[model samples]
Structure formats: structure tokens, C-alpha cells
Target: MGSSHQTVIVTFNQPGASFGQDAVAALEDRLVGAIEAAQAGEFDGNLIDCGEVRLFAFGPDASDLFAAMEPHLRAFPARPAHATLRIGNTEQRVEL
Candidate 1:
């Protein structure tokens, strides 16, 4: 079942800045709950920090998962962020 799950990667472009750990953790919790409530997907609990922050989630459908997380992503204090929704072999980038 997990092998067939699709993925959504949301990258927050913070450049030289990043959100506080507490803030990010809170957002992750809220987003995960929202996604589960919507039956969109399961968060992989992966947070990558490079120059930006990347959040990952996986499910049977990427579009559905993206839809579930879009609002929260938009509500994030970060100004510039984007999500890469991968369904099957195709990927679509959305600015949030």
C-alpha cells in the first residue's frame, strides 16, 4: 500500500531565514491533522532544512492531499512557498 502512495513536497523559500522550530512543529501538527481529517494523506514526518524548509506527505492521491494542505500552507506566515504535487509519473508545481 505504501509503495503506491503519491507525494506532495512543499518548500518554503526562506533564503537566509527560517521559521522558528516551535512554529514549524505546530504547523506540521495542524497540517497533519487537517490532512487526515480530509482523508487526503499521511504526513511522512520529514522536515528538511537547506536554504529553505521542505515538508513532505504521501497518500493514494496527490491532488487530494494538495487540496487538503493548500489552505494551511497559504495561512503560513512565510511569504513565498510552493508545493510540488506528484501523481504517478507526473508532477505539478503550485505556488502557495
Candidate 2:
């Protein structure tokens, strides 16, 4: 099979809100767990790589799949307002 690249952009509801040092640390831990889970196929989809602000996964199902992972994220100011997904050459924006 050919390679497929997927990117998920998560934006917070309150854009300027700060997460604080404690919250940021906690969030980092949770994100690491999420990435590990994705690599282990624990999520509905697979996550191949990730960064501080972006998640790189396989397939075009990022919006639906990542939405499910939202509740598990603890450091957001309110929920994520939206998610932007790029699968291969196609880009899609989704509001949450």
C-alpha cells in the first residue's frame, strides 16, 4: 500500500487563555499517553507521529476519531473550538 499522511490541527475555544505550568505539565503527560495509545492501536485510528500542537496519523478519519479523544484532554480552555484535518492533498475544516 502507498503512504498516507494525515494532520489534525486542534484549536482551543479560548484562544488567549493560559494553561499555567501545572496544567501544561499535565497536558503534556496526557498527550504522550494519547500518542502512545494511538501507536498501540488503542484509539479508533492510528497515530504515527505527533508534535506539541499537531497530531500526525493515518487515514482521513481524523476529525471523527480525534473528536472522540477530546474529552480525555484536560488542559483546554473550554473545549476545542474546531479541528483542521489534512489528509494527503485534501484539507478539511471541522467545527466542534
- Give one digit per residue, the lDDT tens place, for model 2 in 1-96: 134435565544444544344554455466557655655222222222221233333433555446545555433654455566666677787665
Question: What shift in Å separates residue 46 of candidate 2 from its native position after superposition?
Answer: 20
Best by TM-score: 1
RMSD of each: 1.6, 6.6
Which sections of candidate 1 miss by over 4 Å?
1-3
What's the residue-level lDDT of 96 in candidate 2? 55
- What is the alpha-carbon lDDT for the whole of candidate 2? 0.48
TM-score for each model: 0.89, 0.51
Q: What is candidate 1's CA lDDT for residue 41? A: 77
| Candidate 1 TM-score, C-alpha based | 0.89
Alpha-carbon local distance difference test for all models: 0.85, 0.48
Backbone atom clashes (below 3 Å) for every candidate? 0, 0
Q: Give per-residue CA lDDT, model 1, range 1-96, as digits (tens).
A: 466899999988776666777777888998899898999879887565765778999998898998888889999987588999988878999988
